[model samples]
Target: MTRREEIVDVAERLLERGGPEAVTMRRLADELGIQAPSLYKHVAGKPEIEAALQQRALQRLAAALEAAPDLPSLAAAYRRWALRHPRLYEIATRLPLARERLAPGVEAAAAAPLLRVTGGDLTAARALWGLAHGLVDLELAGRFPPGADLDAVWTHAMAARVAAGPGPGVTG
Candidate 1:
């Protein structure tokens, strides 16, 4: 791996182990067997490294979405990806990249799951994306009853909406 890739790999591992707060430049340099200064040759610093991770997480998410066998199966994949990379997941969901910093088309790709369904223009597209994301977050946070799996609940909800049918589609 390139030095940049190596740095990001280490940061992601730290995130997996202890969440965002645990990922530090010193710890990353230690894990890499290189001094902290060496990281600057590759990444700007802790903040930039975290931003790199955010983009990488979105790329990983895009791959996960593409690899799913079908749309309905994606809920489980989504949860698995989130739990597997909790800090990265949190960063990916919460971090707001500076307008100039986002990799072109990455945000669009990250929101592809909802976009594929509604094919809505940007405004409606954002609304559907919010619905999908809000449902996932709320469910994961245990906002519902005990013994509940919000992922499954979300899938059922999506299925019910589709089965409910569309306007002017005719036939029951």
Candidate 2:
């Protein structure tokens, strides 16, 4: 691979091992066998590197999300990705910047996978995003408590959402 591509791979390892804080320009330089100044030729700074890394993570996650056939399968796949690639998944979702800060093509590339599944309407799409994203985020955070049957709970929740429907106020 080329030098810039090599740098991205090294940065990915650094992110996978240490999360955001572990990836410094100097540390990346050290890992890359190049001086810190030379490193700037590939990535502008730590901020840019972090953004690129997050973009990479998002693209990976989007690909995984796309491979699943449906929502339950998608959730299972998401859990698997989170469990297997916790640091990268975390970096993908937890970058400490606004959506605007993300690279121009990165979010679009990453979201293409999801947007394909969530077409037609905005409200339904928003709810689906909220449900899936929230569930995965909570699962990663261990919010379900120990020894609990998350599969059953998740099924019930999904059922309720399906039955209740995202509509006008139904409360009595």
Candidate 3:
């Protein structure tokens, strides 16, 4: 792999292991067995590395979401992905994204599937995304009580939204 790709790979590992704070240039360099200054030769710095990782995460999520046959499947895919990659999801969804650093369309691509599944209703799309993210975040944070039957919770919540029906002129 190319040096930049290698750097990003290692950065992802660090992020998965310890969240954003664990992904420092010095730490990355240490993980890669190189001097801290040498990381600059391959990547701009931590922010750039983070942007790259976010792009990757979004691209993968978009692919998963796009492949879903229905809203429940879409919601399941969203939850499964977030739970599998909690730190990556956390960083990718964090506010004040480094949009300028990301490749063009990465953000929109990630959202497009949700928009489509919501029948182009932006509010509904946001609500679905919010529900999925909030539930995953709570689960990751251990906020749910033991044996909460989260699968049922997800199904009930999504069923409620689906039953509400899309807004005017909307079709899913």
- Backbone clashes under 3 angstroms, per model: 0, 0, 0
- What is candidate 3's lDDT per residue for 23-58, written digit by digit as tens? 888999998899999999987777788788888888
Please rank every candidate by lDDT, starting with the best. 3, 2, 1
Structural similarity to truth (TM-score) of each candidate: 0.77, 0.77, 0.90
Which candidate would rank higher by TM-score, 1 or 2? 2
Q: Global lDDT of each model?
A: 0.70, 0.71, 0.87
lDDT of 1 by residue, 1-172 (tens): 7888888888888888887788878888999898878788888777787778889988888777766554355555766777666567778888886545678988778777644544334454455446556776675566778877665777776686456433342232
lDDT of 2 by residue, 1-172 (tens): 8887788789899877887678778888999777889987776677776677777788788788877765567667767777788888877777774466666776666555444444433354457666766777787788977888877866876676567454452222
Candidate 3 residue spans exceeding 4 A from truth: 169-172
Question: lDDT score of model 1?
Answer: 0.70
- Kindly indicate the candidate among 2 and 3 with the higher lDDT: 3
Q: Candidate 1's error at 46, in angstroms?
A: 1.5
**Winner by TM-score:** 3
The residue pairs found clashing in candidate 3 are none
